[model samples]
Target chain A: MVSKPPPDATRRSEKSRRAIYAAALSLVGEVGYPRTTVEGIAARAGVGKQTIYRWWPSKADVLLEAFLDLSRQAAQEAGQEPYAIPDTGDLAADLKAVLRLTVDQLLDPRFEAPSRALAAEGLVNEPLGREFVTKLLEPQLQLYVDRLRAAQEAGEVRAGVDCRIALELFVSPLAQRWLQHTGPISYDYTDTLVEYALHGIASQPPRSA
Target chain B: MVSKPPPDATRRSEKSRRAIYAAALSLVGEVGYPRTTVEGIAARAGVGKQTIYRWWPSKADVLLEAFLDLSRQAAQEAGQEPYAIPDTGDLAADLKAVLRLTVDQLLDPRFEAPSRALAAEGLVNEPLGREFVTKLLEPQLQLYVDRLRAAQEAGEVRAGVDCRIALELFVSPLAQRWLQHTGPISYDYTDTLVEYALHGIASQPPRSA
Candidate 1:
């Protein structure tokens, strides 16, 4: 059976939700996780404290959902389907394209400061770290797994390779670089990662004479 | 001219130095970077405040040098040279051995807590992140570069590959898994990373008829 659509009240609630998300992100970026408060978010969002509390259990929950929403909006703005990686039947090309988009997201001023703040806290806070990973990171990583598994079925990837681990070959380098300031990130760098990940670093053995 | 030998006073100074390092590590691990103070370390080590100040300019300096000293001791205990990765002529075997040792070190209790504390701080603290990278991480990574360069000379690794970027294929996955609690880190996982990084995930093509 079809469910009824959300009422006009739901539209007002959606507006309030967007305001709360923007406020939460900006506040966290400015004051960091420790100093960011529910009251502060409520005031900045121009909503009652109970309104925020009614929707989210804590500031962390608010921030998490805010980030998820931000990512969805970014994907949409980039003309990409949210929650899905494109498979153009070219695994390398598909992977490189997705990673280039990720590089843009990572470098985005709107995304960077707040993300770094949250990630910094997560590094020290084990429960929060696990929560963010479960809700935010693991799902994104699973998209890569799906793409890799499809490639395996297509004879592009080795059958025995673990898709989860294989995805890390390209994904983790970019993550480490962003998180640790270990290296410069660019479209070229991500494209090179995809290329190197697909082609062996060792020279191809010579054909039989 | 030959340098003068240290007097009996030098032995006393060395003892105090070790005590200070242990105190610094344990304090930071317990309370985290922000709350850890030079005064706390001095009290814990049973040294005067002036003793800590005379030796270290700030808590950060103390922590950095303490970590460096801890790493040296760990390397010595493992019966490995402090500043070198062993080259056994077989690149995969050598890299695997070093990584296994790294896995152990990452899991070690003494190394885990203080390291996490420092790394957590480094994530949001840019200057500190750059300092630790320059002092600690970049040097270790350079060792891999040197090793990979040797492999290139011996025709094991393909020429025209950037060893710095190549090493990240294996290294960053483990770093991400450990830093983010993304997955279970194990010998098997690291071994798979090395195999994938060397030969890649793509299936081998058929030889020419």
Candidate 2:
């Protein structure tokens, strides 16, 4: 168990944390990762450098936490539970609904710029990339895995299929389009992805095979 | 038709071009996009800065052509035609074979460093990303589209399905695994992607619907 801070002190800490997150995200978005500095984030956040260091050890930590917070807030704003994919038993519909939310998050201006900056940095910075993926992305991916496992047990997915790789069929296409600007993204597009992933592009015979 | 240069002059130009490509790729791979310069590439290539400027207008142009040349050389060395996916009337086999080659290319040290450097830069640099995609990636993707179109005509694919999007069900998964290091890539992995893509991930019904 941990001791709680008094109300006023807690409020002050919360305010500082929010400011720091906003500053870190915006600064990284504007300047790109290499140019973003802790001092700069501190200055922009209007908090002393010590205040930031006391909470987070490195700029990467601050940014990572900031991103996590932002995602949680985005999920809340979208009326989504941040931790789990909804399981309605109708797998395609559930997957489509959740992916539509992802489409919204990806398109949201607040999320887009900073996420792109960080993703670009991650491409070359392997340690940071692995850290962010392990902490942030892999967890989110695991939600899909859990959902897929449920799907497998329900006899929706094939028994031998790796749920991890199976999830990528629908997920990575949207990611590639968004990251590489390979194509336009929309609810319709993602819906098509889910459908294609479920039923496949091959011509189905008149009867179930 | 264009006039041919004298044989000796052409040979000298070819040598210079190869040297410039090597210099550009290695320089970008080592120092990254922002720091790679015409002067630096020329110096490394043992050619005058004028030679580089005369051929390519900017560092981006140089890098783009260098990548295109490298890809062509890689494909040729792998015994693949530079522009087309093979069609042996077996869609799954052809896609799997092409993807296996991609797995090899992705793992090759000669391709990995420079491609990652450029791909990282492309993530942040929108215009360069679009330009490279248009000149290099889109053409490659079009080959898949064409193959899928052929598959559609042969009754292997559903006629109404979008070939471009269908191709992503396999291609983007491999790409994401390679780009994000989300998973290990291998021939077996790609072969599985072909299988899952050709058939859906969902358990097939006793008869096709």
Candidate 3:
């Protein structure tokens, strides 16, 4: 249904797109979401305002794509396959590994400010918050859902457990600590979360890890 | 050194205090943290600005105390002992009971808006965020710690478990869902969280409960 662009034109467009993403991320971090404008993004990226409009419907769309791109970059930097959790036949180990990487990503200075700004705005701004969750957060969470389902199939997780809520046992604690400064986050902390989540905090340990 | 006020004056001040707290809660909920002001709260509450300043040093202080008072009120309404989880020799039942009350509190229209506004502000404002955790959140979380410790002593929870982080297994999930709109909040959901926290999501169920 669509014609492909020439390779040279595509390259040029890609360059502009990356620049726009960078500009959007930094601008949102510095000014916060309420003050971030499409024109400001276009000016910072050195693209025409019309060029931004050509790709994204609104500033929210631009910001969302920018954050999506950021997550992709962070995943690549960590040597993780984007949008996927490793399944090495050991659910606890795999979950722990992924959570440790999350700990790193959360503490990354480049990721922290913009994320906080966007999240803060999202709290009061319901439409934007839902969009952020739908476009950005939920996709990442789906990866965990996939991983847990696999574990269920392999008999690592109980059949009756809700994978969606199951993932939160480990994930949300780390999130709370990072988001609210509730506690210190470390590889050890995340490792504990995984262990606690998989085996539980009850007296009888379910199984040897 | 504290001087006792006359009983009649104290009664008048108590009424003014309740009015001020109500004003602070509603103003923050409607206008959000940045736009909310002491002057506006005083105007809405029908108190002089000096009356507010005499009690609380800042808007944040006013909001914090307002939240604290609100929590106490909610607990009383729920027929719960304020700030304490019950010990019925069944950790799971006790946790579920408290979390169900929390679920009710989170979904309350009176609690929701002001909480989201203050929490959103806290996400970016580090000092305010830290103060909120220290004064408001940690105190609440510590009650969980206390309950968890009691369970540990009762040999219900693992002795090796860190009660602080262990509480997060159930608590943070509910918190994240409410804060981010990631999922539905219900007594069923919270009860499931307690079950998952106690017995875990692994293949082998740990305990009979």
Name the top lDDT candidate. 3
Top-DockQ structure, candidate number: 3
| lDDT tens per residue, model 3, A1-209 | 89999999999999999999999988988998999999999999999999999999999999898888888899999898989999999888899899988888898888998999999998899999998998899989999999999999999898888999999999999999999999999999998888888878887653333
Q: Which window of ten consecutive residues has the lowest lDDT sum in model 3 chain A?
A: A200-209
**What residue runs in model 1 are displaced by over 4 Å at the alpha carbon?**
A1-7, A204-209, B1-6, B204-209
- Clash count, candidate 3: 0
Best of the candidates, TM-score? 2
Candidate 2's residue-wise lDDT over B1-209, tens digit each? Answer: 99999999999999999999999999998999989999999999999999999999999999989989988998999988998999999888899999999999899998888888888888889999899889888999999999999999999988688999999999999988888878889998888877777777888532334
Alpha-carbon runs more than 4 Å astray in model 3: A205-209, B1-3, B204-209
- Residue B65 C-alpha lDDT in model 1: 94
lDDT tens digits, residue span B1-209, model 1: 97765877788888889999999999998998989999999999999989999988999999989999988988889999987888888888888888988898899989888888888888888898888988889999999999999988998878777999999999999999998899999999998888888778887532210
After superposition, candidate 2 runs with Cα above 4 Å error = A204-209, B204-209
Over A75-161, each residue of candidate 1 has an lDDT whose tens digit, in order, gives: 999999999999999898899999999999999999998998898888778899899999999999999999999999999988788
Q: How close to the true structure is residue B152 of candidate 3, measured as C-alpha lDDT?
A: 92
TM-score (C-alpha) between model 1 and the true structure:
0.95
TM-score for each prediction?
0.95, 0.97, 0.96
DockQ of 2: 0.63
Measured against the true chain A, the candidates' chain A TM-scores are 0.94, 0.96, 0.94
Relative to the real complex, the DockQ score for model 1 comes to: 0.62
